[model samples]
Target chain A: MATLEIRDLHVSVDAENGPREILKGVDLTVKQGETHAIMGPNGSGKSTLAYSLAGHPKYTVTGGSVLLDGEDVLEMSVDERAKAGVFLAMQYPVEVPGVSVSNFLRTAATAVRGEAPKLRLWVKEVKEAMAALQMDPAFAERNVNEGFSGGEKKRHEILQLELLKPKIAILDETDSGLDVDALRIVSEGINRVRSTGEVGTLLVTHYTRILRYIQPDYVHVFAGGRIVESGGAELADKLENEGYEAYVKGGASE
Target chain B: MAEQNTTGSTTAGSIEVGTAGAGAQLAGPGTGRTTVHQPIDARVAVKPSFDVNDFPVPTGREEDWRFTPLHRLGGLHDGTAAAGERGEDKVGFTLPDGVTAETVGRDDARLGKAGTPVDRVAAQAFSGFEQALVVTVPKDAVLTEPVRIDVRGEGGVRFAHVVIDVKPFAEAVVVLNHEGTGTRAANVELLVGDGAKLTFVSVQDWDRDAVHAAQHSALVGRDASYKSVVVTFGGDLVRLHPRVSYAGPGGEAELFGLYFADAGQHLEHRLVIDHDTPHCRSNVAYKGALQGQDAHAVWVGDVLIRAAAVGTDTYELNRNLVLTDGARVDSIPNLEIETGEIVGAGHASATGRFDDEQLFYLQARGIPADEARRLVVRGFFAELLQQIGVAEVQDQLMEKIDAELEAAV
Candidate 1:
């Protein structure tokens, strides 16, 4: 039902020296219900694409056309983009002191859903989602990410993904700091949402270990600030065996 | 009164410059010491006195007065403004059973027992008031209701003094609510008796054109507990100095304050906790938020631990949240410890602007900019607000904070 198209997207970030381009003429299209795994090495602009689509002020879209269902996504404000159903699971979610998780979730849901959810049903919904994520009941009363462990932070991001239920959810390195058990738990949460078949996922990672669990429908090799190769899920297995060193060297020569 | 006068003069003693660890040992020099020397540190250099002449008018240069704007004080510091007669409704009190409230002459023996005037304004307030209101809770009595004193100021120069005395083994809560328009200077003395427990709250909700300065001095008695909460929301210029000293061993004090400043308003809080006795503890935490141009806030916390005060546990923390471009915050926390034998002593101060990343995180979840700002600001003050035990006061303060946020937007 929803489609995201990124055409020749050029993004720049203010580096210490000057404005440096990160995503150089990158293009991609993802439709609802599709799982696209963007595989890359460090500093290969995989995360840049995710943040740009979410409208982070840090990355300036120099030349790009990001359209969501024929609407210009690039012209929308960050919150507007979110209200239009785009979510970014940040690699490092900032700590918000004094804001309890329950309060934050309710506020966010009220903003996104355009009406405050019914109290009884909303509480029950949050309780059930947290239980599925194996989060403690007391976690709802805690300040957001105040003193959470790395695994706990990742789980919290997935909890938001499930609750917010955005049309396009970009998971930015969700498996980077997760342990084996945590990885399995988080992947299970993602697959549960994917089973709804109403959300498109852009799973950006530097490893193929997570692909083993989620089974991406499309795998894109990102190098030199753009996608250099695209294929089916078999490409993820090839990268698992051969590694990104091949594309890193080949993209540099281009 | 004679003993107080002698101590006041001897403690006013001499100023010692460039002396090592002089500030930590200068709390009470009249306890049998002949050659008393003042600490070079301006915070504790000036001794307390009941006479206004002993302290000179602050020209906004002294460390204690530097953060304060003297021009906006409406002549409370220099004794230039004429005192207008206060109406009968100026000061009113609501006392529960077993509690007494009366107006006593300044010559009463109980007037200056808790503390002497620390600065020129406090001394002026001490020497200027015609009568002092004294509220006392009887010995061994526990009150179910709070004692409320409402001081409503009419537009004029005014001087006021109040004393809250809790008898031995008594437990009570006191709320001092200040409102209306006035250029006023006040001194409040809190005396917690042996084995007594007291919680005192002072709310400064004045009019927009008011200028007010007050010193709150608390004496924690033997084995007693004292808690003071100062909330400042309205007023063009407001400065509060809350000081605590232990009267005996095993005393405990907790001082908490919250303030929000709007455009062209100056709110300052200065705190001093003197650990002059052994086995006493103190904690100070103050938080403030500023919005709009020229909205300034100052918080200075000074904790002195003398050598005689062994087994002392003290810590002071201050945090400021600047919510706009031109708002400013000055937070200074100073701890001077003369003994290494104490339990623990530390201080911390931090002033930070509204975080953009926090806003982004909230907005990414679909919260609008203004609502996100409100949430973050509310959360910033939530912890300190909960410490205020009175629910009605807390709700009112939250509403005021929301109004401040809305006005800023």
Candidate 2:
């Protein structure tokens, strides 16, 4: 099975006093065709985990390593890791003022594929994909994320995920700012892509509303930079009902 | 020093005077004195109605030339002339149909007059053209290609003038390229008729020893539109002054510029947008990057919204990126609004280092530090390329920027 494995990953941001540890020995794994949801409260290093796995320089990996199908992922650059079938739907995608969505998508796709997409067919395909997500065709002409509404930026991230067609995607708080309608649209889009591509998915979120749309194969509770517990899809239901207090109090004794 | 008389008194109120002629006093460094030269009735062969003496000397005192590097003058302004060679003409850049370049000017008249406001001077060493190459777009003519003007320099100083006229309802895109070596000067005049549209792009990519001075003036008529883009790449010193006026109602003007200065190069751009008539719109955006020790760049943008120019919409911005520790960029955006009740009139100017977040993002993407920096610079310029509107021209510009980035690293 194609698997992404994170082994006792320790991370920190460099400080004059020494490295201030952020993620302390966090471990997790997911296989292809599987959907894993990581639920955690604020300041639990969830975003740090996503950024570190994506090779963001600010979140240094002080110990351990990340591997994709036995290949060391920490060794690859950000774009290289992305090209190697790993996509991170950023929590806040930076707005590139002068780059149009069409242009940015074309370049990213071209970079991932190592060749230019066919000109005539490229336009038609992009239009169709945008339509599938219920996004306006005019959005393609606008600068990437520039002047976009909060929901629009989130939808844009999903659009890139659909177009880039990565093997596995780690979505960081993709549902944070999305409204009910936008969240539904975003969930539907994710479902459509996963069903079609049969790719592995890792959903990082604090809410359970999105779980109703895309049922997770497994749910893991994260606290203190480590996975405290792992269970079936019912685990998400438990967290949604009981909250993280039970796990937090239980983990306090460990 | 012995007295040297360059030019003697020719007539009453008219003097055949050369500041370089013996007896003409030259200013030395640390001399706080500013000499005011007597205005001479200067005559240029082409466009005799326009007087070259009225042009001001770009001193640091003027708001328009404040950001310019006056220290680079280094005693080079004393009687320095441009090398003018009238050989076979060549054209670059794809041009639309019905537009062509022709040489114009008489033997006694040359384009390009230099100096500060008081000591206004014209390059006399360069030969004058009897007839300036004219690019005429007939009335109702709509062009599908972009016209290119290729100006080449070998050595010394060269002066050439080109006049472009767009008749009513005519549309065209014109590109002028200054390539080769030595010091060169040019004056470009664009006259657009009512309801006409014209886009002009000037690219200065000369050899290391080259010094370029260019003046662009446009007279836009009622309901007409004019757009100009200037790119400065290679040169020891390059200065461009672009003046545009909406002389009639419903006119629109856009001025866009991008420059990349390497080590030891100094580039300056001065832009003036005059909103003379009502319902006119003008937008100006200029961006630049300076790298290497002592590489300096400047951008001066002035937008004048006269009282008569009601309902005018004007916006301007200048952004510069300093790559090296010793690199510097100075920018000034000036907006003069006469009427309080106007539609949108403002400007912004900024000069700083590369954004750390952008750099980190690119580096995380697997691009090395150098390549990542190049990507950021390229992306910074991509803003202009997006507005170029022409595929071939845009591709060529991108390629040129890529070459510059490669060599710069």
Candidate 3:
């Protein structure tokens, strides 16, 4: 079974003088066919976790290791990690103007599959995926994430997750800018793709609305670069009702 | 072959000069024309290395020479003298195996192409380097690695011309680099045979005080493809003219340019795609960024679908980003389609400042304002870089261009 393990992972950026630690000894384990939602407020290293896993150069991994199915993730390059069945649906997807979505998808899909997809079958698969997302076929011809609305960008990310079929998908605040209709469409797309029981997901978010669409097996509250609380699905409701002020102050005092 | 040398000095400067349009259509005797003349010893200017004929002068009437700077001929001279010896440090980039570079003067027997008349007046007046270096990629040759050619100009008036011949079924990437700290003008001719493909890159990183000028002429035959990418970041007055023609059916050509101009720099790019046959296609895209006082850049793209070029499909676009009040960019895209049976023909040109909406979007996403602008610029140029298709080279170029963008802002 596929798995994602982050053990004492630390990260930093290159500021003037020296590196500043961003991720401080954060540990987490996500198994295949499981949904784990990491809830956190703004500026609490949520996106940093996503970038550190994606091998963004600005975020240096000062210590700790990321493993996938017992293989060291830190040893792989960004593209290599991508090929190793690790996918990050960026909270703010990088807008690649002049690169068609279909073309970019095929390239990334080809990289994951270890070979170029057959032209005929690839077209059919992309069309079917677009239909499943209720997206116009012409969107594939448009540049990747270029001029896409807020909800469209999120849905596009889920569309990629569905088509690429990664072993462990990382959704970093994918629901932040989405509206109610967009959230439902995006979450429905995710649910349909994960229903096959072949993929696991780590859903990083702050809202519980998305969780209502796609249920999580485990809910973890992240504060001060570490998980402060872990519980079943009911934990998300409690946090939503009580707010994060108490936990944030309690963690800060420690 | 004999060496002739001449040394002369002339002083000419023009202030409050109007913008020189791409097609030289200003319509005045002194608008874009100037002449300079000074007397000096003849021995210092001559190049007698191999042998070449002096190119002829133009009356400012020829189609190819119409849009060029014509008034700089007052201080020009001709010579057959050998060039001054320079150490290896002056020249960079070792040639690949099986490739040969020979330095030949104007008097050489192979100076000009067969059946082409020599322009003696223009050759003597416009030549910058003393000798011409010719490189050849043999027939059926496939170079797994790129060939680097560095043309270094030490000082004084220098002119160099490079001739490249890619034989049939051959594939290669030829990087012609212009690097030096003096006045320079280099001309290059690329000839690709049937069923051959060539990715030619011209990187202009000349000294900031240098006046750089170049002309690239290429001919693509049946089933052949050619892609030229020009990146210019240095030089006081740099101008590149790329003239390409498709000689047979099913031929393709792409012209791409990226330029950044800062204070006191004037960079210009002129491209012409001549579709002489049916079923040929050509595309041109040139983008630039300009900042600071008197920073000016021009892009003129012309696609000509001749009468015989039925079924031809051509498109061209020129976009510029102006970053300062004193900076300016001029873009002109033209399409002249003679045949009505063509597949498609379109052209577009636009000039605008940074988009405030995009900046706000990125800033609202938690990116600092400055870094947000950087990301927007990266996102803007990423489309072009991705099309370059060479991962390592693209990454390296991206890092360098990113640094330039950061420094500019």
Candidate 4:
């Protein structure tokens, strides 16, 4: 089992004036087999936290530590973090032209697995995973996310999550653009990985609909660059009905 | 920065420039249009003259010679670089069934039937060559395999000429492979008979210090089709000029090129297609990647549609990917349309660095920066590699591309 710990994390991004702090003194702990739901309104630094833990170069870790099983993730490069079993399913997955989906996935798997997988077995694995997510096998030959629809992009993220089999995955708004059916399918994919009981998941979303399919062990209400409230699953139901009005007002600048 | 990926579409006049507009200038040439120092004058087209003195030496200021370093021509231009000193041309041919390969003297009637020398280098090649080789396919015959011509330079300065002729209704593919280069200047001619189809492939895989200059011309007959595939990978300096003209209506021509210019290598490809007849079509696509300091690539595509040409459709595209610093590309697309009653004409040229977002995306997937860099560059060239129909050629090109990328680090 693996554990990811973020201690007093402070992240900043370069703006017109200077480095503007986005994550201020945020602390979080995620253990393998545990689901942590970080729910927040727009511009509350929830995505920032996801990117920071994933070692995005744009998000500078000023005064914090991102540890994956006691190894300093901040000092590691982006790919290093991924090899260390930390995966980030970006809210906006990048489009890479000229790179076929099969090539990209195999390359990534080779890096993570330390050797190239057998071609026949690998092709079978991809076809099965894509079929599970309702993706056509043709997606393997197309360029990576080149002309995929939003729902296709979401499903592709889940496809990677299933294939990569990381120790922990941070899904940033995986349910944002998915329709009801796609959401259910993507949620099923997530639940399949969750049921494996060897991976931790941090689902960052604005709605509680996806939580119904993939239940979180703990829910953290994020506001003002920090988690202001935490509870066992019940907190999500409270936010679904009461909304973030009380938390936003409570954490507003005085 | 490379040209932003754009779907092919028919546009009105020629000369289309593409821009990434993503603000990621990876230090490529700023001028996105074709880079020809001057327009090719009307006098560039003429009958082949087998006299060295018929063509004057270039001052490197002419439109055709502007991008070429004249001092590096290995003496094929100014009469200073004599023949049979630096390299000797060793020619061999492997012909398929029902094809003929012949070595004829300069007076052979079949010589120079496809094209004439337009510049001093071509004229010098025509006059100075000790012997010329001609390959022909019989009428109403179709070949299953391609005819292979291996031109290997043993040593010394060599002047050479070659001709490929396909009779009426005959279809054939010809591959001209150059290796073990020296200082060499040569001229190649293609004659496609009525209702014939021909695919001519010229590969220049020269030595690191070799210098080569060649002019290629094709004459398309009525209802004939011509396809030219030019692949250049290794050379200190290599310049190839490919041109085409029509003899009858309903003819078609397609020109495709693939090049990889490494450190201190200069690869220049100049093409001209003259549509003097009606109902002719032409399409040109050339892709190149340059790496290392002082690695440069130049592409000049010129298409002319005469008033007599009524139903003409033509489009030219040149794309360059600059992989490392100190590498530059000059792309110039020129179209001179004398008639407005044509079907369509267009050209596109783009040169840029690798997309930063592409690299980041790959790296985020746990691919190391070096490996990711190699993958991105390979991806940039993958599309063109698929166009090479020969399995062996494609595999060799892939290995060469990988080796070049490995040295980039």
Best by lDDT: 1
For candidate 3, write residues B264-337 as lDDT tens digits. 78888877676667998887877787889988887877666666777888777777778789987766565555
Q: DockQ for each candidate?
A: 0.79, 0.24, 0.06, 0.65
lDDT at B263, model 2: 84
Q: Each candidate: what lDDT?
A: 0.84, 0.72, 0.69, 0.83
Model 4, A139-224: lDDT tens per residue? 89988888889998989889999998999999999999888999999999999999999899999998999998889999998888
CAPRI category for model 3: incorrect
lDDT of 1 at A62: 95
Q: Candidate 3 i-RMS (Å)?
A: 9.8
**Better candidate number, 2 or 3, judged by TM-score:** 2
List, residue by residue over B1-409, the lDDT tens digit for candidate 1: 0001112111111222222344322332133432212223345456767678788888888878888889898878887743444433277788999899989887666676666677888888887888888899999999887899988887778778888999999999899998898888888989999999999999898998988889898889999999999989889999998988887999999998999898999999988787778999998889888888999998878777767788999877788888888998877776666677778776666777778899989999999988998889888887787777768667877787777678764
Weakest ten-residue segment in model 3 chain A by summed lDDT: A245-254
Q: Indicate the fraction of true inter-chain contacts that candidate 3 also forms.
A: 0.10
Off by over 4 Å in 2: A14-19, A113-131, A136-142, A163-167, A192-198, A245-254, B1-76, B82-141, B167-169, B323-325, B352-376, B390-392, B402-409
User: How are the candidates ranked when ordered by TM-score, highest leading?
Assistant: 1, 4, 2, 3
RMSD after Cα superposition, model 1 = 6.2
By TM-score, who's the top model here?
1
* Candidate 1 chain B lDDT trough over 10 residues, lowest sum: B1-10
